[model samples]
Target: MLSWVQKRGTSEHRTGLETPLQGPKQRCWFVWDPMGIIFAIATWALVLSGAWVLVRDLLIPSNNVFYAIANGVVFHLLASLALVSHLRTMLTDPGSVPLGNPPGPDTVSYCPFCLCAIPERVYHCTVCRRCIRKNDHHCPWVNNCVGEDNQKYFLLFTLYVGLMSTHVLLLLAIPVLRSHARGEWNASSTVSLPGPIFFLFLVALMGFIFALVMLCSQMCSIYKDKTTTEMLHQNKHSQGRQSMWANIKAICGPRVSLAWLSPFHSPDRYKVSERHVMA
Candidate 1:
């Protein structure tokens, strides 16, 4: 892929998006765009920076060994899960249709950009330069498109990030709240947050807000049997059966299990027999 990009050079207008694939490429799913790569790196940098500051300024300095150890363990665990989920979402194939695949039963129209016939709910991601099945949207944060194949990882990413952020915020806030309750803090008491702590607070707050909004949106999309792209385009015709639980199971897995919460687990594969077209 890198060699292919180098051959095309950067001066080309659309580069990857406009150029149709001449042949079937290997299954590596990384996006080669500069912006996406930078954003992905920044995401890791911020997560690591927050962890370092939290450990240095908040967790290690605590007087109680048990308190520090417990919080540190929980925070690191959640952080690890969030990062792993993000990596999985970024690297996993998001159900890309075969390049230049011949028209079939589900074919709606040919994508000029990808030179392939795409089915219902399929959309072309310019960044990824592929027609993704049930493409939701291209997220620079994860540096990939969210679609049928990897929505579970995207959801898990948001969930774990939200939990970790909330945990950090609560740890930073509770002491102040307790002090105010005990009358140790007053309007003129002039308690101020240190620079590093303030920076950590901002990071946690941003992560929490972003994760909460995204998680809620993804949940609603799943329940309605739609993608973010479908919602935005107002494509309301149902592509599959309308059972909420069934849709959830389809994205998360075949059955309810702890694996649903795991980034290591892949979602149940979508079988053609399980899908039907409306007449």
Candidate 2:
């Protein structure tokens, strides 16, 4: 009876859907994540709306508004370009090169979730559930993984976006500040003067400023040929000593901008050679 019971239990476990067991490997090119998509859309919307307002106000021949708008648009465009470039690299790059023929030994290590072999300087993103080539941390706002391909673009995006947002805030503030100085409103004035719009503008300004500062700091580290992981490790060991500017210049090189835009350096291009890696 004990043997029968044991066999019954084994059979039941095998048939149970809740039981954890390894299944056949399934290959898929793209996996959709709705939350990620939504986040990306929202960020893009903010950028577009800000650009529209700046352009519209400038066209009205309102004091320095055009200059402010142009500055804001340029900055945001640069930043967005950087981020998009980085994200594109990550998505296209194959995780690893498969062993030819009989496949005796697995030459590369891979994360189970993403099913991609880890590349040199790459890391696994827990949130995105993928092994990114030259992986940087996942960016929540962009809803995309940052890796070797898109890193430069991502950096550009951060820098420009920050500059644009800050410029807009200042431009908007000048008129209000000037009016306030002239005692335009009473102390208890309840009159609506685009207050809600201004409040939203302030919120966006603050948010972008914080994001820009953080991204710029990270970009400085990356330019030094260091990952956030490596930076933290070095900091812990060396009491927060940062990499020198010379080191960063060496890694980034003189033609960094050209290299950044070239698709040859992109992770999506399977032909990426060691020459593409920064020193």
Candidate achieving the largest TM-score:
1
TM-score (C-alpha, index-matched) for candidate 1: 0.89
Give the Cα lDDT of each candidate.
0.82, 0.50
**Across residues 1-279, which tens digit of lDDT does each residue of candidate 2 receive?**
334434444565465522111123235323256776776667666666655655554434555666656665565665466346434433433232221111111112334454433323546666656555555466666566655545545554565566666666666677778888999878786645455456548645765776677677666665565666556555332122145553333333434366644333532232333312322
Screening candidate 1 with a backbone cut-off below 3 angstroms (N, C-alpha, C), the clashing residue pairs are none
Q: Write the per-residue lDDT of candidate 1 for residues 242-275, one digit (tens) a residue.
A: 6888888888888899999999887777565453
lDDT of 2 at 205: 77
Cand. 2 Cα-lDDT: 0.50
Total clashing pairs for each candidate: 0, 10
Q: What is the C-alpha RMSD of each candidate to the true structure, in Å?
A: 8.6, 11.6
Give TM per candidate. 0.89, 0.58
Name the lDDT of candidate 1: 0.82
